[model samples]
Target: MAVVFDKPTLLQRIAPIFQGFDGPLVFAILLLACAGLMTMYSVGFDHGSRFASHGRNMMLAAGVLFVVSQVPPQRLMALAVPMYVVGVALLLAVFLFGIQKKGAQRWLNVGVVIQPSELMKVAMPLMLAWWFQRREGQLKPLDFVVAGLLLAIPAALILKQPDLGTTLLVVASGLAVIFFAGLSWKLIIPPVLLGMVGVVTLIAMEPQWCAPDVDWRVLHEYQRQRVCTLLDPFKDPLGKGFHIIQGMIAIGSGGVWGKGFMQGTQTHLEFIPERTTDFIFAAFSEEFGLVGTLALMAAFLFLLIRGLIIAMEAPTLFSRLVAAAMTANFFVYAFVNMGMVSGILPVVGVPLPFISYGGTAMVTLGVCLGILMSVAKSKRLMQS
Candidate 1:
């Protein structure tokens, strides 16, 4: 047989590109990709075309993963500031003449309609990492303030767009970068306390402060309803609260053992809303029970732990910040979606990350993972 040098193998020959692969990181990605495929199958059981679309998206994500893992961390650092500036400008464009759907304008149209906020999810951490990298030996107290400003500007815009879920995710991701970059616990404590107080105050004054007569002209009507519904879903079960009520029922009905795969009563009966998106975890719990849930959580934990180990061993501050932020984003995504599904947190329409069915989110997360892999690979190559 003649030896043939094909595209894939020939492409793999580049030194800096695909130099040292991370096994654990790759395993984590594979697990999430599998979970995505399984959940999408259920989500689009009636509409098989969705499964095909998801497959295509996964293929694209994998390609992105490969391409991004090849880029050197130093190069990624160089690309950060420019990318962040572009992201912010796109967000401004969105605010000006974005597409409005369900009374919220989060998507912009330059050539195609897309969510610029998703780009921020990747750009924010990159920018912060680059900033911290620059101030490596002499990180001042005021540096945190500058980073806070970097995070807050776009977060405020996203929040005003009333895309509460993504705004919070982006904030969490950016803060993770700062935290990993050696933010002090003393500095972290005050904000933690204030956030708790704010939550309590919101809950305490849910009726008056969140009432219609308060002239909620600042908030879109549906956003107000979502907050109110989070406080008490029973107030309007048939209206805004329907999704939460149904999701909880589906989850609670699972008991010790699940009702079995594809045999969920609530799911089959069409009682569970957004079963393949934010509420997919609830549906999975309904079908696979406690055992399945634990297995999934364990996989996520393994991924997080391995990611942190990689961050700790990274060759540079930028790599460490990028790795840690990506890991924390995964944690935040899982926590928020599960919290919302269980009715512990307000519904803000954040997806279940890999398990959810959205091309934009899947690709954004894929890119995040790619950055993590790049960091991990750089560390390994230096050691080798």
Candidate 2:
């Protein structure tokens, strides 16, 4: 004989899967993801596949976030060292016999092409956070020295691949961990002062230094040209400066209000380079204008603040460090992308978080948000 039973309600069935999610964080991510989907639809108005592909990527990212958020912070720390070691080892593999693409040796091909540098974006923070957590009570200058060494190795390897944007990102992520771990003010001051002085010096000496014939030994010629281009984009209006000029036009022409969705002349006319990736902000600005730009900026600012709050309230040193690094990474992603697209900084292939169309980056972002959610949920559990 069989017994008949009533089926569980939908919420009862779904509740266990989302058992520990931080509601606000998940909602914030969903909002951004929705905006990304809408923008991608407009970006690929004529090509339905591009928009559909972006939707698929977002779904993939949402899956990653859900799966990853289920893992608690302590267990995350347990996997940190091994993940970091594998990441660095893969970077070495890329250095030794990497696949070359578009003149950069940043990919390691096993069964498929993968950018090992992307691994460091997450791994570096994990490694540093774990390192600091281990030395929580007895931290010293030497520990930071060792941390710097850990950061330098993979960063140098990626730099040799000639991917400056990713190198900067990895370095920044590691430094965020260190900074949150209470590295001295003295350690921070010199770099800030020197950077200010360097900028002043560059501006003052631009006439002779930015000359085409001069060889800049410190940076690759193309990198040096990007700096020069930022200093004065008009110097090569239709050449090195073309991207910046077009981006600026799209942004400025948007004026106080904007041209409305799918109505950006510069975007549709094909003047804005990489309109769906690096320069997506320009197209966005052209359509949404200042009001929409402010709204978007506010959303990012809220995310940043929310992530930092989670970091500050995390129960352990490792969680704090990881959370802070992840939060700072978001700021860098938003600031650098906006700066370059607005012509205030040189173009670096950094995508605008959810707004940019790319699979690997979206997955990485999903992992980041998932980790933050895990940390936040852990705090709620502790309180209960």
Candidate 1, residue 260: CA error in Å? 0.8
TM-scores of all candidate predictions against the true structure: 0.92, 0.96
Over 1-384, each residue of candidate 1 has an lDDT whose tens digit, in order, gives 999876666555664465688988888878977977886787678755877888888888888878898888999999999999999998998889889998789998878888999999999999999999999999999999999999999999888787988999999999999998889999999989999998899899888876667756766777778778989899889988899999999988888788987788898788888777778888888887888888888888888999899989998889899999999999999989999998998888888877877888878877988888888888878888
lDDT string for model 2 (97-153, tens) is: 999888889998899989989989999999999999999999989999999999999
Worst 10 residues of 2 by lDDT: 18-27
Per-residue lDDT of 40 in model 2: 80
List clash counts for every candidate, in order.
0, 0
Worst 10 residues of 1 by lDDT: 9-18
Looking at model 1, residue 159 earns an lDDT score of 85
Query: Over 4 Å off in model 1, which ranges?
Result: 1-19, 215-219
Question: Which candidate number has the best lDDT?
Answer: 2
